[model samples]
Target chain A: MNVIVCVKQIPDPALPGALDGATNTLKRDGKLILDDSDAYGVEMALQLVDAAGGGEVSIISMAPNGETAGMRTALAMGAAKGILVSDPALQGSDALTTAKVLAAAAQRLGGADLIIAATESSDGYTGTVPEQMAEVLGLPSVTFAKKVKIDGGVLKADRQTEEGYDEVECALPALISVTAGVVEPRYPSFKGIMAAKSKPVEEVTASDLGVTPAGWAGAGQKVMLVAQAEARQAGEIVEDDGESFGKIVAFLENLKVI
Target chain B: MAINSVWVFAQVTNGAATTGTLELLTKARSLSPNVTAVLGGDASGVAAQLGEFGATKVYATGDLAGKLPGVAVAGAMKAIIDGGDKPDLILFPQNYEGRDVLARLSVKLNKSVLTNSIDVAVDGDSVNATTPIFGGNTLVTTTFTGEGPYLVAFRPKSFAAEASGGAPAAIAAASVPDLGATGGAKVTAVHVEESTGPKLDEANIVVSGGRGLGEADKYAMIEELAKLLKGAPGASRAIVDAGWVPYSYQVGQTGKVVKPSVYIAAGISGATQHMVGMKGAKNIIAINKDKEAPIFGIADLGIVGDVHKVLPKLIEALKGR
Candidate 1:
């Protein structure tokens, strides 16, 4: 079984990111690193490949400036190879357009038995790419998966929902988006890190994957304006007068929450 | 400059409309005069509530029985729209099930989806949804460039759920198309993690812990405090990411969006992702040792103290310590 995992190289989200006022886009000129959210997907893909007797785990990422730093992390974790899709035309791409490029990349790879992705990107957080990719690929998609297993050519998962959990099973050649904590991500060993440096990384442009700018350029929706979010009004700050707990209790009581 | 009709993919759980669905329906009322609910399973139990929230008509796909319902819902709705009986705008809750249905619908309809919308407003005949990007640093107002049956998903609790004194909607049966061999990923079994008290999203007061809790074991204090206050226990993305808690406990942009009446942040530094989920809280009380934590900016009450010390004390104080 072969698996493809989608990832993104994002500016460190721990630090604040700036917007290009002129373009109203996130400034991506800063140093980028592997988004932590993608790690679970990578880990899930690796484990799935390992459990399937012998298989390869490949990564598909769309990065600015042709950044492979993030994808390298997954490669270091034992993924066989990586593909980076970068192009200026791809800049400011919306969720569906990005999914188109990814699906096209999957086609270039001659397709895979399955594709996996994070439930949502830590940066974009749109939570639509996986489903969109599934649509483009014309495959079944099980999202928010907490547990995934493959047996007898059947892909089964415990998909998470607001109510609780649902047990879902689908045939191979499907797509899945795993939530964080689906599995504990393993640390890349030093040996694995050294081996990753030699792993071949394939680079391609959007058109190289047969994605024409005109096809996705004018996304169905357009971002009209971006403004600083209004700050939630500050209410009160209190010091521990050896009775701060009491004050909170009183506050909650006053609000009738208790 | 008016939307002819609005459709909400109403979510029903245990024979009632989820608060988030009702909330979306409530907001949908303001956006369009003709509001309809596109629901799954029998709408009989939830029809009254959906109506009370301003649903004029209920379009249900009957009962899905065991299928996940999303695929069939999308297929059914696609048939409806293709039949030229399309709503001007469609709204869905930003949930696992909701995203699945809407995303598939986006493909089936050859449209795109606008998700994580914080708010929506009318501009001429177009409906623009405000979505916070850069982890809530900036808000971008987006609207479709062309065509009808626009798809948009609003975050849970983005709008308040209120009754409009409307009569029960006229419930109509909708056909569920045949789900293929995959069977919408057949649900085989279900396991509900046992816990006491109300659900986190529905709770009036929510107490969430962050990485400051040190370890998974310390989350007990959070459950304790939530119990004392009769609230629900929630966790920041930090702890949930660190494997300290289940994703179900996560409250944030990427997780569950909550807007309880009172939200207490214990040891949470309040990352933008986490803040997006609960910032709508009527009152926010943050407890963290770092006085400079960004959470203080939005906190209705900021308590500068370590969770290790503050939580136990608060729990003990409530226990008459």
Candidate 2:
């Protein structure tokens, strides 16, 4: 079955992430890499398409600056092509607008039998985009999938929950948001990296997709204010005085947790 | 800000409202007097208790027994809103089921969802939510720019839950829509992982282990201590990835967000990824050999000792006590 995976380019989370003070948005002017979370989707999509025998995996991403660096990494992992929606108007777009644009890009790619995405972006963590995309595309969504399988064109998964897991079944052309470590992501090989350069990445804009980036369509959630979250003050730090064992029990009892 | 009505998605489990639902209902009381609870399944058993938390009315949908909540409950709520029974503000608990319903409703109604809200305020005709972003580095107050029936999901323990000593609320039934393809995502089977003691999320005191534990065998100590305290056991991504524990026991950014009364970390160096999930706990105790470990930076009690040596003595002492 053909697949379209939505990946994101997020600032390297290992270092630091800053918000544009003037715009109240995540600063996107630095180096970016494929969000580690999305790697599972990209990998899962490639494996599914390969298991399906000869179907292709395409990618759709919405980022400013035509961020092809992250897209190329996915292509190296075996996605056939990519559609990057990069426009100044699309900047600061909330999860809804991002989903709309990606939905449009899915149509531009002639749609797909399966659409995969990480449960949420590491940067935003809204956990709403993939479901919104499924709604916009009018397809069923099975999110937080821990294990996925295909049988007779049916997309089945073991969806994760608070207590346990639910084995869910849906049709093709459905959307599935996978949790991390669903499968061990494979790194791009030397040959795959070289071929990724020639792999085409078509760029598009909101207007081209027949969607406007103004008023409600631009950003439905307006940022009223952005400030540093009050840092959690470190509590009493006592060196383990052999008496520490007794101290811990008293702490739990004092809190009435024991 | 005289609000017309406020609604809360009161999640019901085992014929009763979840604690998180009660918390949302309690907070909704401060927002408006006309607090309605939108529940799934038979809320008749707990409708009276909902009133104690300030719900004036309960709208429980029918026949969602075996269907996925996202498809059944969300479809029902969409129908209710479309019928012009919309409220000014809708509160959702930031959780698996809550996220599913909120996202589906957001798309169905063409509205925006403000997530991970720590606090919510109403002004004139708008509702604003303060959410911490960038992994708790900063806070951003967000408000919807579009039409009403605004959606906001509160993080766990974001608000206090208390009874207002009110009478039982009236119960009404909502017709569950014929969830055709929407309910196509049917759960075929449920596999409950073998776990001991209380659930990590529901536990009042949580004890978590990290990579500092040399191997998987040492995790027994973490569980032992948790069992002693009548708490729950949790693990960081390092051990979970190393195949020491199941993903359900993992606590971090992508895993469960727990805010137990006290969180104890054994051998964890406190990576930021792990910090974001448990930092909200009321009291944090870190046990690591490294005094400069990042976990100690935010820990309420830092025990600069080896987990191997400290946990044994701690467990032995607790067993005797």
Candidate 3:
């Protein structure tokens, strides 16, 4: 079975002020890492291919020019090939538009028996794309999956729910979006790192996929990004004395916590 | 042709209706009088309650005794989309089940899915959704420009619960196609964490302990206060990793995101990850030994004192209240 994994290069969320001052957008700085959830998806796909007695695992990503480092990381993790769908036109696209571009690219790749993605993007945190891509490609999508396995041409997965979890089974050529607990993504080794350089990467443009600027723009909703986020003010610290306990009690009482 | 109506996924568990079902119905009622509440379960007499919640029409799919919610929601959404009764907006609660179903339905229907929205207002030919980004530090208002139904998942406990007062409407049982083979793994067993406190996500008041408490045993102070308030116990990532508290109660970037009305952080330094989970809280209180703990910045009330001393006193004050 052939598997495809959709990966994203998000900004290091640990950094302060990771947004660009001029564009009012997230600044890809410090480090461009594979979205943590997508790494799990990639790992799941690799395991599936290996279990199937050697199938191909293709890594797909959409990002700005600086995200090539992330693409290379996926290659080093053991994907047979990489596909990067990047262009200046694809910038500023919201979750919906991003799904459209990805769906179009997946279609151009001649499709696959299985598609995998993280539950949500760390930066966007939308958690909407995998389902959106499945809709666009007319496939069944099972999301928030904690465990997945392929048996007898059927894909079985354990999905997490509030009450607990439910076991489910679906046929091949389906999409699965994994949660964090699914698998621990393996780090690249020296041998894998050396092999990644020779791995062929296919690059595609939005225009080449017939996704025009207007067509690629989001249609459902408009997002009004706030100009600035006001930082919280520094607070006072009372001394660690008997008097401090009274002050703390008084504060909680005033806040109605008492 | 007349616009059909807006659809709200009226989720019911163990025959009890969820709070979000009513909230979404209220929002849908405001958008258009033609609102349908689709309930997927065999719970008796739920249609009458749905009508009280402002549902003009009620569709009960049947009893979902052995069915997965993801399967039920996808089937119901598909039926609504295919019955020549296309909804302009599809609202879901940003809960675990809601997210799963909406994510699949959005893809199946080719609609834009928006999650963690705080507010939704109807605009001409579209809806404007307000969702927080970069945690609750900033709010982004989004509108979709396409022709499909606008899908949104509202954060739980964000909207005020509206009273459902109207008379019952004639119930209709809608037929939904079963998407063969749920496709994926099946659950073998469930291990529920045994605890005796209010659920952290649903609690109105939450008292969270952080690393500043210094040790796992010190959590007793935090628990005492929670008990006094008849609220739930929560913890920061610092405490969870130290095994001071269960991972279920941990609130941070990697744990549950909650929006309780009142949140008290004891000994928490307020890392951004921890802040993102509770920043939507209506009011915040912080108590720490350090004068410059980051949590104090967003806190409406702050007491810079040792939590070991401060929490005991606060618990005493609450006992007196």
For candidate 2, the TM-score is: 0.93
Model 2 chain B, poorest ten-residue lDDT window? B179-188
Docking class of 1: medium
In order of appearance, the predictions have TM-scores of 0.95, 0.93, 0.82
Q: In candidate 1 chain A, where is summed lDDT lowest over 10 consecutive residues?
A: A213-222
What tens digits encode model 3's per-residue C-alpha lDDT throughout A198-251?
998878888878776433354455455553456555445455666665665665
Candidate 3 residue-wise lDDT, B156-255, digit = tens: 6557668568666457776657556442323345445556767788888898999988878889888888888878899986676455665567786556
Model 2, runs deviating above 4 Å: A214-217, A235-258, B178-180, B192-194, B241-243
| Candidate order by decreasing DockQ | 1, 2, 3
Q: Against the true chain A, what TM-score does chain A of candidate 2 give?
A: 0.91
Candidate 1 Cα errors over 4 Å, as ranges: A214-216, A235-243, A253-258, B134-137, B178-184
**Which should have the higher lDDT, number 1 or number 2?**
2
**Local distance difference test, per candidate?**
0.84, 0.85, 0.74
Error of 2 at A126 (Å): 0.6
